[model samples]
Every structure is written in structure tokens, then in C-alpha cells.
Target: MFTDPIADYLTRIRNASRAGHRVVEVPASNLKKEITKILFDQGYILSYKFEDDQAQGSIKIALKYDKMTKEPVIRKIQRISKPGLRKYSGSEELPRVLNGLGIAIVSTSHGVMTSKQAKKEKVGGEVLCYVY
Candidate 1:
């Protein structure tokens, strides 16, 4: 059984990219879906879709690649919150990944959003992950 699905999700994508896989499948959950959406919106990933199954569903992600360099768009992905230690932050204390070059996914009261959006909306939440 997976103790941390978010970490698993990120690891799956990371491994797939390292192996030069175009796509990777992960066990689905609402949080995972939200994270996937955030990644797509930030242009780190190409696309994703959820498939229904008898048990929990599955998510298929189309990894992104550069046209000229043929390199993975996302160079790194890090999970902040975990089952043991839950990290939270306010809008003012929100992190700027790579001096704003990367994206930090935050789970706010308004819902899951990027640190930039959370800051704009003046909300604080648990720091989910940082992506570059």
C-alpha cells in the first residue's frame, strides 16, 4: 500500500521522464487530480486524463518535452507535505520556487492553487510541492 500518494505521483513522473517515456500512469485520487491539473496549467506537463475502474481510478499523464532540445520540461518535482509532518503557510510566507522560475503548489482554503495565485488571492495553505 502507498503511504503517500502525492510523492508516488511525482516519483512516477520523474521516473518516466528519466526513462524517456512519453506517458505514465498513476493511481487516481482527488488530490492527485488537483495536482495534475496544477502541473498542466503551469505548462510542466502536456496533458492528463482520469480513467474509472472497479477500485480507485487511474490517471494517465502525457509528459512534456522540448521541441529542439528534446529535454523534459520538468527538471524537478518535490513534495512538501507528508503524512507525518504537515506544512502550512500564509500568503505572505508563501515560497517562491527557484526564485519564481519553479512553481509551488499550495492547498488553500479556496482550494488547491499555486503560490502565486494564493498570494494574489490573499490566502494561505499547506505547501504541497515545488516543481521546476
Candidate 2:
């Protein structure tokens, strides 16, 4: 039911999931739709596996309207580490570092993403496919 490149990406994710590989979820909002669109335009789709067949693996992402909320809630499917970077000493400093690099932390239907990526593509709402 997926179209071309999107289907391909979904298949890849599904296969990886079946093999027990971990995947990252990036969330986003309207401002980040550009990024999600980019992924779609490039034929990329996100998918995930579930414990039950009936369960929709798709996620629902919403825009952050409250300025009070600073960080997007991210679900860690795999251990994420910066290449060649040591563990951060302070939890408070993490956002400063990520933001310094122009990454926008967002909660998406698929997961979380940097503002840069979200602005580049169009991704939001409920997931239509499980990555794998």
C-alpha cells in the first residue's frame, strides 16, 4: 500500500526490526513539516514493529504550542551516542549542546527530530507504516 521509495524505507525498517535492530524516533511539529515532507518527497517512510498484530505501530505527533516546554519526549529504541564524544557530564548541558548545533528537538508521530530535519521534511500525525 506504500508508494515506491517510502515503501522501500519502510521495508528496510521492518526488516531491521525483525532482526532485533534498534531504531530512533524523531518527533516534529508544523514548523518541522518541511523535513517530513523531504523524507516523503525522497520516498522515505517510517515504520515500526509491535507486540501484537492488531496494534497500530504508527505514532501521533503534535505541535508544541507551549513555550514552557523545552524538550521533546523521545523514545529510545537504541543507545544513542555522539561519534567519538564522551558521555555528557551534566544532564542540563545536553540541550545546550544539541541546540548549539541547530538541532530542533521535536516530538513527532514517528518520534523526535532536530528542528533542522523537521523543517526539511514533512512528518507529523499518525504513522501510516511500521518501519520494521
Candidate 3:
């Protein structure tokens, strides 16, 4: 069993995008909310809203697409650090996605952030996922 909620979150979005769904919903958690925020901030997603229903809360995400091209903004998303094989990196060893064109979301001591932000903050932790 994977038991990786983060990976589940990413796969849900990926499946929805492939199905051309405008909105996708996932069971909510603080970590998922932070990741959604990062995706929104990086322009990979259009918007997101968190619905609180106690332990049954969820997140609604608006997937982004190019207006003129009708192509998804996020071309690829991959879970880099699995629960079985964790990947950790220091600030200097952070992965550069697509030669800086894409972003690697990292869970740092400071917080979950894009690799660029991590580099700027001079910290690093788990390399969570890659988005391009």
C-alpha cells in the first residue's frame, strides 16, 4: 500500500485534467491546502477553495488551461519522493526542473514551497513533486 496522500492528491488532479474536468475535488488536509495554494500561486491552477465540514472537509480546485490554445497549463506532474523511497535534498542539491522552466515542490523546514522559493530561502527538505 502506498499510503501517500500527497501522491493521491497529485494523481487526482492529473486524472481530472486528462478528463478535461474544470473542477476537481479532493478530501482536504492542511498539507493539501498548502500544495493547492502553491499551485495557484505558480499559475498551474486557476483557483481553489477549501470547504470545511469537520473531518469530511474537501478542497475544490479549478484547473487552468491556456485561453487561446485550450491546452492544460500543467503538462506533467510526478511524485518524486515515494513513501518507500524518500528523497531529501539540501538547499544546494535542490533539483532544477526543466532548467528552471518547471517547478519542484519541496517540503522544507520553512514550509512547503517551490524549488525557487526554497533556493531563495536557503533551505530544503523532501522533493515532493514536479510540475511543468
TM-score of each: 0.96, 0.20, 0.96
What's model 1's lDDT at 4?
87
**Which parts of model 3 are misplaced by more than 4 Å?**
none
Indicate the residue-level lDDT of 74 in model 2. 22
Candidate 2 achieves a global lDDT of 0.33
For model 2 the local lDDT of residue 91 reads 21
- Model 2, span 7-117: residue lDDT tens: 343344344434444453333233334434433332333422222233433322221112365322221112123223323212222232233432324344545454334
Cα-based lDDT for every prediction: 0.93, 0.33, 0.93
Tens digits of lDDT, candidate 1, 42-102: 9998999899973988999999999999999989988898889999998899999999999
Candidate 1, which segments miss by more than 4 Å at Cα?
Answer: none
- Candidate 1: residue 11 Cα off by (Å): 0.7
lDDT of 2 at 67: 31
lDDT of 2 at 47: 29
